[model samples]
Target: MKSKKIPERLESKRLLLRKLNHTDAPGLYANIRDKEISRWLSGVPYPYPKDLALKFVLTAIAKFENKKRFTFGITIKGIKKEAVGVISLEKVDYKNKNAMLGYWIGKKYWGKGYMTEAVKEVLSFGFETIGLHRIYANVYSENPASERILRKFGFIFEGVEREKFFKEGEWQDYLTYGLLKKEYSKAM
Candidate 1:
């Protein structure tokens, strides 16, 4: 399957997934600044500096143009402009038709199915628009909520990598989940 540019916006029942922009820096920083929010995320700096947030938005813009990744800011429809979460497909491999999925929602947005909704839409974009054969996500072994979300989406349990990431000053285990194009088609 050939790759296509990700759409400017994707909508579900209550959420709109759109491209991140300069104006989003403050919201992105506010949402992700919490240690609880940043803990499981591997690369996000713990302090979550304002400068880093700005840099992230800029980098996200660059990555999208290069087709290296597609990142979306999650906002409630007709509720506000600030993002409550973010979701993205990174490490895209055109030859292998695969990519890595990553996402996080603010604690206030947890248990409301927002991430689930956003992820399902992003997964569709990955498989249908980007022509990905497989899209995978890795979760911290201790994070069952994330694991449950992946399971609900029909992502298969692939394997575990012990001490796979050094986060918050300690090594952590990671559980991998994957969904193939055929499986996604069936689920959809």
Candidate 2:
């Protein structure tokens, strides 16, 4: 399987999974900086500062230099020029041809199927464009919405741990889900 030498932006029916920009800090910060939103997310800290957001965008750009995996700033197609969510591929193993998918969306947009749509677009990119063999999503057991999105993406519930995460000052269970190239190919 061959990875695209150049990173490609993916577009779905309602989204443009484009590259993140430093200018996106203001809009992204507005939606993602709160503890309510960042609670379960591992690296994104509560009360995320503008400086940190800028750093995030910078790091996103830097990922392109390596060329195997990338993240996107999720923007709605018809809406104003702003990011309502962000999604990405991480821990890509080119030899194994796999990557773990992750995402976050604005709270107001929850229950609208936005996250599922975005996940589908990226998974399609991984399997179709990037020639990847597998993709997976992990979530805290309490995050039913994320679990729902992965299920809708055709990921199967694989396993769970007793105390796989420690977030917001407490320990919690982590639910792991995964989809294989074989499974996705069969579904297609």
Candidate 3:
């Protein structure tokens, strides 16, 4: 299959999702360093070292360039340089036309509908722009907010994986949600 060029930036009513850059390190560090944020995320370390943010930014850039993953930094309209969160389509499988969706916003920005807006934009890109067949997300069962966002987009609850992740000194169940292109088109 031929590759499609992913856009460097996507815009929503109140948010701008753009490719990660070197200058995003500070903002990424500030938002991701919170223990509350890191606990929900499987990969992020608890302390969330300052330097790791830069490393992550650089790695995201490389992955974007290689078309391996698409990671967008979430920023509000006026303040484009300061990222409040991140949303990504990772583990992209061009042959299968599927990808996994992952996202998180800072504690300060939660409950304001920023993630819901961002997810809508990214799902559009993945299904319509990139021509993906399916997009799925795995959320820890403890995170009802994340599950609600997926439900709003018409993602079906596929199933649950028992003891899928060990975070914060205990095992956690993962609730899988999936949306096919047909489902997205119908909802839209």
Candidate 4:
């Protein structure tokens, strides 16, 4: 894991997030293959493959070309700066001053408060740099851990959409939560 001759994109206590690159496909494949990691994830497929990782990286490049939003690979602050997770802003409605936040941590990194810290940093980036008024997150009802993380970040629970998501061969509910710029500022 060589340091990129470039500066780190965003830093948390334990994470030094940076832009996704083609070289990350191997690490993505290795860490993202477990079913547990993909269970609540909307886009990541079960039995994730290396080729799909390459495709995903290409999509990230395309997103950059179109300037949709930013997706970061979360790496720890050390010599081996391999990505331990991902965090992203999507559906950026600049006119409405809002965006959607999403993330997932590798199996080994779960329950260690990594996602919470990453989400906080990304939210700061959203309000301060992206200048967004609102940022929201959607988590499957079965995935209470994500809802807890959002709550810890001061995201208000909006409501649950019944049978709104169809995945893993079954329909499931989704918990929609949101945090406004005021709420974020108050938290800080």
RMSD of each: 1.3, 1.6, 1.1, 4.7
- What is the per-residue lDDT of model 2 for residues 1-188, given as tens digits with 9 covering 90 to 100? 44346555788888888888778888888889778789878788877877887788788878855754578889988884677778988887888888988899888877878888898888887888788888987788788888877877679998988787688889988777999988887876
Cα TM-score of candidate 3:
0.97
Q: How many backbone clashes does candidate 1 have?
A: 0
Better of 1 and 4 by TM-score: 1
| lDDT (tens digit, per residue) of candidate 3 on 1-188 | 33656799999999999998899889889889998888888899988888999999999999999988999999999755677789999998999999999999888888999999999999999998888999999988888898999999999999999998899899999889999999999998
Model 4, span 1-188: residue lDDT tens? 01113233889888888888888878878888989888888888887866998898778767744557678888877644777678988888878989899888788878888888899889988888768899999999878889899989899999989988788889988888999999999998
How big is the positional error of residue 68 in model 2, measured in Å on the Cα after superposition? 4.6
lDDT of 4 at 25: 77
Q: Which regions of candidate 1 are displaced past 4 Å? A: 1-5
Badly placed stretches (over 4 Å) of model 4 are 1-8
Task: Give the per-residue lDDT of model 1 (tens digit) for 1-188.
Answer: 43454587999999999988989888888889999988989888788888998899999989987888889989998877877788999999999999999999888888988988999999989998888999999998889889998988899999999998888879999889999999999988
Q: What lDDT score goes with residue 13 in model 1?
A: 98
Question: How does residue 102 of candidate 1 score in lDDT?
Answer: 98
Question: What is the TM-score ranking, best to worst?
Answer: 3, 1, 2, 4
**Candidate 4: C-alpha lDDT:** 0.82
Please give the ranking of all candidate structures by lDDT, highest first, separated by commas.
3, 1, 4, 2
Error (Å) of candidate 2 at residue 118 is 0.8
